[model samples]
Target: MGHINNKYYLGFEGEPEIIFTVVQKNNEKSEISIWSGYFNNIMQQITPVEGKWTALAYYYNLNIGWYDESPWLVDNIEDAYKQFKSIDKYKLDDLEEEILEEILELFKKSIEENNNVYISYE
Candidate 1:
């Protein structure tokens, strides 16, 4: 099965603050973790997605004079951090809450350092 993957850049090709990840057979970093969700209804609804993502990228492409390549700009990454931080603690299991906290740490570091978080399905 295909899995969603993310990579962060410090505006350079260095190690990123990875929020979600898994390992592969060759000891390489790969994606595919089935235990990613726990059944809190709100958790199911939680994701760091911008609603007008496609439109934003489309306009960005036009501004760059490129019709074929539309890449989402990293300027809006604060929205992603806010989503992760918006989880209601009362509804989550202790483990789920802990996981979210851990993930938020990565977001915090990246944001503070002004890095770019990249998500793709590989």
Candidate 2:
């Protein structure tokens, strides 16, 4: 029998976060765990799959562009802190929540439309 391969999404609310896990069967007796990561943006996670592996992504809506804005665009932790110090506090609070809800709705729609093609790991 072929080894079971599967993918799962951990969170679907609040912020745009995703976890991707790939399991490959190395032999008839065991399986190996492969790549995994969390993406905060929709564009960053969009890519084509290659070889004998498949890809899966799960994300919320609020965090779509949260990290791409200024102050958060620093190269490292120290730079981020320094930039944050000079940023206007109220400017960060103006982000719209409705947009997040719309994005989440779109994600759900895509998943539902593609449900028939997915193989359940559980």
For model 2, the stretches where C-alpha displacement exceeds 4 angstroms are 1-95, 115-122
Candidate 1: minimum summed lDDT over ten consecutive residues — where?
A: 31-40
**Tens digit of per-residue lDDT, candidate 1, span 1-122:** 32443322223233222223322334344331113223123244354346433322333324431223222233455665676577676777675666566556645765786655433211
The pairs that clash in candidate 1 are none
* Cand. 2 TM to true fold: 0.20
Each model's RMSD to truth, in Å? 12.0, 18.0
Once fitted onto the true fold, the runs of candidate 1 whose alpha carbons sit more than 4 angstroms away are 1-34, 38-42, 45-75, 120-122
Q: How accurate is candidate 1 locally (lDDT)?
A: 0.42
C-alpha TM-score for every candidate = 0.44, 0.20
For all candidates, the clash counts are 0, 0
